[model samples]
Target: MNSEEGRSRPAWGYQALVSLPARTSTPTRELGRRALFALGLLVITVGLVYFDRGAYQDNNADHVVSLVDAIYYATVTITTTGYGDITPVATHARIINAILITPMRILFLVLLVGTTLEVLANEGRRVFRDARWRKRMRNHIVVVGYGTKGRAAVKTLEKNNCNPAQVVIIDGRPSAISDANIGGYAAIEGDATRRDILRRAEISKAREVIITLDRDDSAILVTLTVRQLNPSAHVVVAVREQDNATLIRQSGADAVVTSSDAVGRLLGLSAVSPNLGTVIEDLLSSGDGLEVSERQVTADEVGKSPGEVMGERVVAVVRNKTLRRFYDPTVARLETGDQLVVVRRSDQAAAPLPSGGERREFGGRRGR
Candidate 1:
């Protein structure tokens, strides 16, 4: 597509939609709240006019006032639609009109103007927030697809101490973007597979890109696009089929998670041995149960056997970006600058690594 494709894609305004859930309310909810308040004012005005029917004079009817005429009077009065058909002739009614009703009318008018006022305020905030984001967008993670897998990935990142501000979500579905926003994240709505959409996310400056699309083909396309944009970034892809995993990895994903195969394996294991599956699921799950974390070798742990390490169980070792099984003789003893992949309890905080430790994807097969 041409560079102007972003401009002509649709009427959806990306800048207008950027928001932090913690700071501001969505336009829809704000408008609804104001509308409800305005309605309440109308109800109170109607009650006041109807309850004191004798205080008002109606030109259209006789000296008596009906509920319908009271409602009509309140409606026209609050809206400043002076039909001249209704008048409050009593001294008390006129005094109430001067003191109370006038203020309520001013409030209703303020509420009406509030819609425009809030828009202007939010617009200015959006512009400032967008500028700040673009300025500080370097080396942040870009996650495409806010579906089940995408949500889980982001949660895992956050649980590992990753900042919510450091992660950006890209999804083609408006509903998914809304969900992400409600979760207190900035989300861009558009097809992530498109180069222009990826560019809008500042793909080139991103430190990592995660692709968890439902369709394997789409996952591959996004992986390719991300790799093309940011070659040095660590790209991860979660695909449904194992066959597509290889293709995605070849497309430049650092690691590939075969979702369907992993789930199937867990199902089979559960059928054969229930406890084994439960333990694995616990490791896969976040929080106090069990977690598999990759962290740097502490000074005391260095020059020691993996089996001698206290508490967490060392499952594997990552040396120079290569994964080595714990049983492998070379990694039997940890060395300085070595990274260990260990299964530890979530209640205890894992030691921070110099390179920013990451959580490994569970239930995935890889070459040692």
Candidate 2:
């Protein structure tokens, strides 16, 4: 294989180290409860045999029933695997066997077999639900890696009116999957870099994919796999190293966020001027001081300059999927399909732009 091909394939050692969460055979509480109940039943059956020792006899080797013999007899009876080695000689012993022992045996069977049946039933239901979900999934977002970045991205999407049901989380860690489940998101417990796992998540039909894997190589592999599976899906990835951003984008990611670089820049800004950093942070945060939002240009605002728009402070305009700054010559006249990326106070509601192409007072306080 060529050097590029070797670099693209996942390493065998890395795959071995990736700990995919195991499929649950049964819920923890249900398994514990059933085990305790079975133990209790065994103890009760043994106790019955001990209290009625004199009434029973062992048919093998001419020995009288002792504690050990009673335990053995109870085990055999509850399991319904009677060996014909123990017999009740007295009438009361037979009566006890009919009324008490039989019920305990039934209870033991229910406790043991019922748990297995429940596990099987749950597996069946999960399979059916997964199949149905995959069939109906479209325009859905697949979030690979439920780490801090992934969680924050999903939260932002949810805040913007995205449905939780439409977001699917994929993570290799059991804890991450548990967290996703607790947050009411459907999750797949497996490595996102694997083609089979992405296929299971129905990446081909996904509308968008957000990759937040810790390692740059894993993120790049996932981006390549997702792009191959769905050529049209918009892939956004987070990279820890700025050097890897270009490589990730080349692997077919639509957008690359260099987290480390951004954080470093913010820290530098804060060191130089604290107020400037604070203002930028406020704009980045949602429902805090100031919020950044993107909305389509209103019909009345078409053919008007960004400076003439009211309500929000238009910082940039997105036309034909390309960003143009407010002062850019291209954005001097807003078009019908243009989108405005603006900043406003968290408490303010956006109002329709006036039809006369006249400027109005910005409703939001510009900065803290």
lDDT of each: 0.83, 0.85
Model 1 lDDT per residue over 186-276, tens place: 8999998899999978899999898889999998888888888888999989999988878998999999999999999999999999888
Which residue pairs show collisions in model 1?
none
Maximum-TM-score candidate: 2
Q: What is candidate 2's TM-score against the reference? A: 0.73
Give the TM-scores of the predictions, in the order they appear: 0.64, 0.73
Alpha-carbon deviation at 251 in model 1, angstroms: 1.7
Q: Candidate 2: what lDDT?
A: 0.85
Sliding window of 10 residues with minimal summed lDDT for model 1: 359-368
TM-score of 1: 0.64
